[model samples]
Target chain A: MPGALHRVLFVDLARHRSWVEDRADLYSESLGGAGVAIELLREHCPERCDPLAPENPIVLAVGPLTSLYPLASKTVAMFKSPLTGNLGESHCGGRSAMALRLAGYGAMVIMDRSPTPVYLSVDAGGVRFRDARTLWGMSSSLTAGRVMLEREGGAGHRTVLRIGPAGENLVTYAGVTVETYRHFGRLGMGAVMGSKHLKGIVIAGNGDLPVADRGAYQRTYRDLYTRAVRSPAMRKYYELGTPENLGPLSAMGALPVRNLQATGYGTEPPLEGEALAREHLGRRLACSHCPTACIHLAALREPHPEAPYFYKTTFVSYDYEPLYALGTMLGVEQPEDALRLLDVVEHLGLDAMSAGVALAWATEAFERGLLDEKALGGLRPAWGDARVYATMLECIARRAGPLYTLLGEGVDAAAAEYGGDSYALAFGGLEMPGYHTGPGAHLTHLTGARHSHLDSAGYAFDQEDMKAGQSRSPKELARALLTEEARRQVLSSLVVCFFARGLYDADTCVACLSAVEKERNWDDLMALGEDILRRKHAFKAREGFEFDALRIPARTLEVPTPLGGLSENTLREAISEVERLLASGERFSHG
Target chain B: MGKRLRVVDVERCVDCLLCAFACARRFGGGGLAKSAIAVRSVGGMERGFVVVVCRACEDPPCLAVCPVGAIRKVEVGVRVDADRCIGCSMCVEACAIGAVQWDAVERKPVICVHCGLCAQYCPHSVLAHEEV
Candidate 1:
């Protein structure tokens, strides 16, 4: 390995001290990202430690391929989630991986909570915990980002990961926003930051790396770059971005509408991707080293309510998940309304998926007379009412009322506390991602490490199986999903975007790893991936996670997917298969 | 063919820093420290980006300011004589566009040779190899 890849930076927020340590052994064995992170979490996190306590640690790791390979731009953030009260891992892309790699570290372990609100600035000069007492209560995360950007000043190469009011309030599902567009948007990473009184993290670096074999490096780099830009897999992302899935998903009757009460967007033109792009696409952006500029910014131009003949243009990012969560799930029918709601979510630095699902539950609860006007704080729960949703989003972020406080804990906790557990859409403590494809989608969310769709990409499996005109047995499907998730451990450890999985297959990943690190082969990487998966599960199990005790919302069986309503028996059988697969992972080792 | 790299579209640049990486690879390394080209956002990325590179100026300020006669005007762009140079960075200071990037490790100004290596790897075509 290059000497740089072995370095780990440790930040003690309690002591306000920062130091660097060279852990070549750990890097040599784990190869960074989730592989290294799981180990770091175990070492630093005390057994039965409070998820919000100072004893819990935050691990942000980048891989050997980071800053050396194209599209290897994701940074894996691992911590014990306060929401799930178990293993928490989230991956974000922007300049995060590159910035960390350039800032002269392979991984960073932040522990010990700050006594007061503070933000960590990491540049070539090393880590400095700056006083952020004044910046703490800023209304929106965007303003907070702007303040940090102006104060820190790395501009293009720097990544500012900051949280908003939601995080500051310790909203369980709040996320740490990356570069204003991307996020470590799952598993309550922001709440962890908030609990430490750590408001944000800033990283900037200009240094580069040394490739062992330049000839092979260049050849492989060119091949990956060419494929990333020119491939058909990336074309849709480049054109309309992830929102391109909006049309197809809606047409296929897989797009969740009105809290999964409906599965399709019925005759709604504004909710479609093509219509939104044509009407509102302002610009497109990409994470560092990624050719596909999948982050689509919609220019929402609306007339200023107070000023005549004046209009305000707000650039809001739109994607399939957020569109489904904030738009369709909340019954937001108009594009502008959905965009406005998304703008609120982004401003508050809340996880759009979790927040949307929580609100969906609230709306249903309100309509069913379980939640009255007193609980809603004068806001009525009505379908397609963006105004009501907007006010409720603020209330939840602030934990303003009895209902909002409960909802702030996420859909599972909210429903459990408030008598709507059956309708709550969360699979684990974490809420469901925007996929109503079939049994595979729900099964993946339940069985995957993070309770996220990206963990196993079960929706893709559903689409593929549908195209093949066949459905596998529950056990067979479990094997396929688990295989993909296991292989993805390599990708996440290398910290590459999941979108580029086709380009960075196991062999290609091994080739890339060999160029950057020493004493590693394809077999070692495969074993390391399996070991990482086991370690993550071990962490979860240690923290009281139970596979058999996993909850599949009753509503999941009620909603008719594209393949019709999923059978409970099949979903339960899939979970059983997952348990057997995980038992094998326990025996796997990194050696 | 004497091809010079040009910032064809600043708006199209995603600030990926691939061009910078490509330039550094010419010296058998990875990083922006030795690269002559620099891509930075104008305050914030949502606004846009600014791609800083040598314009291959007529009667360049860098060549004029070199006290030891280390820099010479080449066919398309200026080249630095590392042997003759005292690393004064007068030439770097002379350039108004801030295209004269300083190598922190070597303590010398790294100027663009207009080799057009950066243009080839530009995925978005933000940079172009213009044939003069």
Candidate 2:
């Protein structure tokens, strides 16, 4: 291990005292990234502490492979979620991982809430806290990022992670946007930072990393880079980006439409990937050391409301989740309107998925007469009304009125207060992700700790089942998802993007790991992956999460999927079986 | 067998820094510490990046500033004699682009050897090894 690998940088916002401590034990066992971050959170976070309180600790970590390998670009941020009041973990990509790693530290732990708005700047040598009073409360969060870029020293080699007014206002679903387009998009991690009066974090560093075997490492790196750039899976991402999934998901009836009220929206011209590629896609972007370049920036050319002759073009990045959440889930028919809504959410620095679900719930509430102009403060909530949705999204971030405040808390909390729990598109208190495949998808969300479709990729498993015609018992499905998710812990710990799962199979990963540190073999790697998953689940369980506590939205079962209509009983049975399998100490073996 | 290495068109560089990685890997066994060239954002990434490497100046300030006579003008570019380097960091300060990278771990200065390994790895033809 490098001499600097053991040191943890500690930043105190109130006192502005920063220090580094050598904790090699944590790094040696946990292996950095989410693994070490979780350990730090356990030690620093007070039990049942208020997530927004000065006591809550935010830990960001980078793995050993960062900046040394391709696709190891994600930074793991772990803290108590202000949204769910449980263990919070969000992974982000941009220049964050490389910056943090190069900055001569393995991890950073921020604690002690600030008295006033501030941002932390870290370089290769030291850390400094700067007052952000002038930069705070900016409507366009990008303005703050631009200011930081100009004022701060590091330019291309640094990452600036900033929050918008949404986070400043403490919107529970607010997120921290980094490198302009990348985000710690889920679990209200931004709200935690805002609660501490933290406006942003900027990191820049340039240092040579020490390795065990330079010759083997270099050869392996070239091989991985070659494979990453040439893979077919990577080509799809580079070409159409994630929006490519939008068309196929919609066609397969997996796209969540109108808050999952309908699986398919016939009235709307399908907002598919192919359509966006033909019309809106302006440019492609990628994270540092990443060749996929899957980021799609869409150019929306529109006449400025004030200046009709002068048309202003806005470029917004679009993806599968955002497209589904803001377009189909909100009943938005016109692609332009969806893009506009996406632009508003992006500027606000709120999670588009949660914001769309919140808005969809509000629209449904209004349609059912559960909410009216009185509750909405004279603002009519309607589906497919992009203008109304845009205004409401901003209002929600700003916490304007009673309705906006409720909506800002997310769909689960909003529905609980407004009598629409039946249609609330949430799982494990977090809003549902884009997928609505079938019983498999719902079951995956219910069983997975994150309650996210990515938890177990149940949709992909559904596709596999379609091909295999093998109806394994619910236990079999749960075991498979759990094993796959556990294996992903290795990827996430290395902080690699999940999109590259095909490229970094277990064998390839072992080969790469051997280049860095030859001590560990394939089995050791697998064990570490399992241990990390268990640790994450333990944190969730400690926060009162139970497999049975998972709620399959009433709307999901009501809507027929492309696979078939998912029955409540089947989903419930699967959930119970999954719980049983999880409770039992059965080691899931992946062949 | 010595060859002069210079960047042909920097505008084509996507800021990937593959050349730097490749340079480091070519010498350091496989790690990034040994790479002689460095890439940094010029101002903001929106503006673009600047590739920092030895310009192979006729009167290289790095060589003149080395207190321990550690730097020498090689056939292709400047090379560092690690045995004599006292970790003085004079060469690093002498170079304007900060191309003379100081290895804090190894207590030595890393100067580009003009090997052109980086140019071979750069998929985009942003970096070129030219005999000037």
Q: How well does each candidate superpose onto the true structure, as a TM-score? A: 0.97, 0.91
Best by the TM-score measure: 1
Q: Which candidate is the best by lDDT?
A: 1
lDDT of 1 by residue, A485-585 (tens): 87889889887889898888767887776665553676767677777887888989989899888988888898788777788889999999888878865
Q: Which window of 10 residues has the lowest lDDT sum in candidate 1 chain A?
A: A582-591
Q: lDDT tens string, model 2, B1-132? A: 556677777665555666766786765643355667776655544444677888888889999998888888877778788888889888989998788876655778888888788887776566777766
Off by over 4 Å in 1: A1-3, A154-156, A266-269, A585-591
All-Cα superposition RMSD per candidate: 2.1, 3.1
Candidate 2 residue spans exceeding 4 A from truth: A1-3, A154-156, A265-269, A308-311, B1-14, B29-113, B129-132
Clashing pairs in 2: A214-B29, A214-B30, A215-B29, A215-B30, A218-B30, B24-B35
lDDT of 2 by residue, A377-426 (tens): 77897778999888888889899987789888888888877888889888
DockQ of each: 0.68, 0.31
